[model samples]
Target chain A: MSALAEILFGGLFQGSLYAMMAVGLALVWTTIGVFNFSHGVFMMLGAYIAWQLVELGLPAAVAFPIAVVVMAGVGWILQASVVRPLIGRPNIVLVVVITTLAAGSLIENGALTIWGPRSKQIPALIDGNTTIGGVGVSLHQIAIIVITPLILAALWMFLNRTRLGLALRAVAQNEDASHLVGLNVTALYGLAFAIAASLAGLAGIFMGGYRFMSPVMGSDPLLKALIVVVFGGISSISGPIFAAYLIGFFEAACSYYFGLYWTPALLFGVLILTLMVRPEGIFASRSRGLA
Target chain B: MNPILTVEGITAGYGRVTVLHDISLEAGRFGNVGLFGPNGHGKTTLLRAISGLLQAKSGRIQFDGQDISGLSARAIVGTGLIHVPQGNRLFPDLSIADCMALGAYSPRARPHEAENREKVVKLFPKLAERWRQRVRTLSGGERQMVSIGTALMSHPRLLILDEPTLGLAPKIKDELCASVMDISRGGVPLIVVEQDIEFLLELTQQLYLVNHGAVATEIKPGESLDHGEIMSMYFGH
Candidate 1:
């Protein structure tokens, strides 16, 4: 029972991180129609930036926000310079996908060149562990568990209650209608990318302390994010959150009972089965059109 | 008085396929004009061009004395020209209230959003009742109401509606036309592209017949429309 409890808690913590990572991809995909193959690179960059800042003597708390801000700026510039030009052009999907993939390669190579291939450890924001129901949990895990809800709540408020967030949602629904209604579509797209990048950056910063950081660490999270978003329903914000938790719990349970090697097979199998059964996602509202 | 909008020899189209050729028209303040023609004769294309969805290959489109030929759809809406597109191009999963709120997205329209919402709700009380409902679930007539109501939320100076009554029952169509006439009477000019000739004649003071991507004729107010002649023209008989 204690072992089960520990796995459940760990799973929840990991799921929340996946939620944070996936939400950005979902937002960008639904709004901008860009799959953003480069999103993982942004996450990697965030981890690196936070790590470098800590190396320069800044505290983890300060380094995290700074990295997020930098990532937001990077997102804005990338969308404006690369993605905006290709919008409304013929074969836009092909162009954007190729451009973003190229950008990801460039970022990865740049990181490799600068930081070398060596892996680095990030100092934890907190030290010590607490016992819950006879299971020991690290302070970092607890922080992640607590912080994820706060972030989700903040994001929910921003999306539903704020004007800019409302505009972003509107654009996501129908770009043409948004423009006819007088929304600055270009600015909204840029804002969406910036927000998405910042969220990914936040996840990266948190994970930097949670686990060892490497130049290629982003690929796994990126794949997990894609899975969560697809399984959750691309159009629904809360859907990915729900799916992330499910995947996280399933993986944890599988790893605990079976083995770590079986976890990937089980996860992918579940994803495939879910896609076949409910392509719109487990949490997706039936009324929502294609994302 | 200067016209609220003027299109002087505007030529526009999709890439390599000219849908409108040298289209010129003008609308006075609070004037209601109807574009009457068969389907695929560029009536919708003309509306799209005026709303800045399609770029003009040549000529000028002036709105309220400002040259707005090259302005984007977003900028055009800022000038108080709102287009309620055909086929109910609404966000299917969004609540009717959210759809209405999004209509007031421009900075210029934001201040008047509440008042406009009130006006729209009053105009279409059905929409008010289903404010929380997703647009996809609404009936055709209800969706049309939402589309028009959404456009009204923008506080438009010139409202362009494309086939607003399409796929609606006769009774609902009559009510919608009445509401549209009410809207026009409330000091907003309208350029409507509709297939219902009786509704068009009842609602508009002037009509333009477009054919082969050009303005073929203008039927002035008080002139009798030769129904057979118009039918033959539309059917290419």
Candidate 2:
């Protein structure tokens, strides 16, 4: 029972982090119709920037925010220069896919050149652990658990309570209608990309403290986020969060009972079965009301 | 009287396929103009050009005495020319209330959102009754009301409606046309592109007959020609 509890708690913390990452990807996907292959690279960039700032004697509080802001600026520039120009052009999807995949490669190689191949360790924001139900959890794990919900709550508020947020939703639904109704579709696209990148940055900062950072660390999280979004449904914001936890627990259970190697097989099996059975996803039957 | 909108020699199209050629028209303040033509001509294209959805290849569009040619659809909305596009392009998943609020998204309309919302609700009481329902759940005519109601939330000075009566029952169409007449009578200038000639004749002060991407003729209300005669002239027997 104690072992079971430990595994479940660990899964919950990891799942929350994946949820943060997946939610951002889902946002950009639903809004802009681009898969954003470079999403993970943004996360890597965030972690490295945060680490460099902390190394330069900046506090974790200031370092993380600066990283997030930098990621947002990167997002804006990427959208304006790369994505916006390709819009309404022939073969846009193919063009964007190639462009973003190339961007990911560039960012990954750039990080390797700058930071080298050695893994960087970031100090935890809060040190110590707490025990619950005969299982011990680190403060970093607790922070991951708490911070994800706070971010989601803030995101919900932004989408529901703000005009720009509503406009974003409008654009996601129908670009032509959004334009006809006086929405600056290009600006909304830029803003959505920025917001999505900022979320990735925040996730990276948290994960950097919780685990070792590497130039390629973002690839795993990126794959997990993609799986979560695919499993949850493309258009839903909350759906991916729910799917993230499910995948997390399943992976944890698989690793505990069988082995770490069996976890990937099970995850892929589930994804294949889901695609065969319900391509629209479990939660997609309900209209994506306001995400 | 100074016309609120003057479009002259405007040519526009979608990606090398020119749909409008030398299209010229004008609408005065508090006046309604109708564009009547067969499908696949230039009625919808011209409206798209005037609303700034499609760019003009040449010539000019002046709105409120300011040159507005080649401006973005978003900027044109700021000038108080709201377009309720065809197929009732309401965000199907959104509540009617949210849809209406989103219509007032332009900076110029933000201050008057609440008041304009009230006016729209009053204009289409059916929409008010189903304010919380998603737009997709509404009937075709009800969705039309929400579509126009959404446009009205922007407090448009010149309202352009495209095929508002499409796919609606005749009873509902009559009710919507009556509501539109009431709106036009309340002094909002209107440019309506529709296939219902009788409805256009009843609702519009003047009508322009379009063919082959150009305005071929202009006719006033109470013209000697009846609906059948106008139809024969426009569509041919």
Highest DockQ against the true fold, candidate: 2
Off by over 4 Å in 1: A286-291
Ten contiguous residues minimizing lDDT sum, candidate 2 chain B = B220-229
Model 2: per-residue Cα lDDT over A12-40, one tens digit each: 88788788888888787777877788889
Clash pairs detected, candidate 2: none
Measured over all alpha carbons after superposition, the RMSD of each candidate to the real structure, in angstroms, is 1.9, 1.6
Per-prediction TM-score, please?
0.96, 0.97
User: Candidate 1: lDDT over CA atoms?
Assistant: 0.85
Ten contiguous residues with the weakest lDDT in model 1 chain B = B25-34
Worst 10 contiguous positions by lDDT, candidate 1 chain A: A282-291
Query: Global lDDT of each model?
Result: 0.85, 0.85
lDDT of 1 at A188: 86
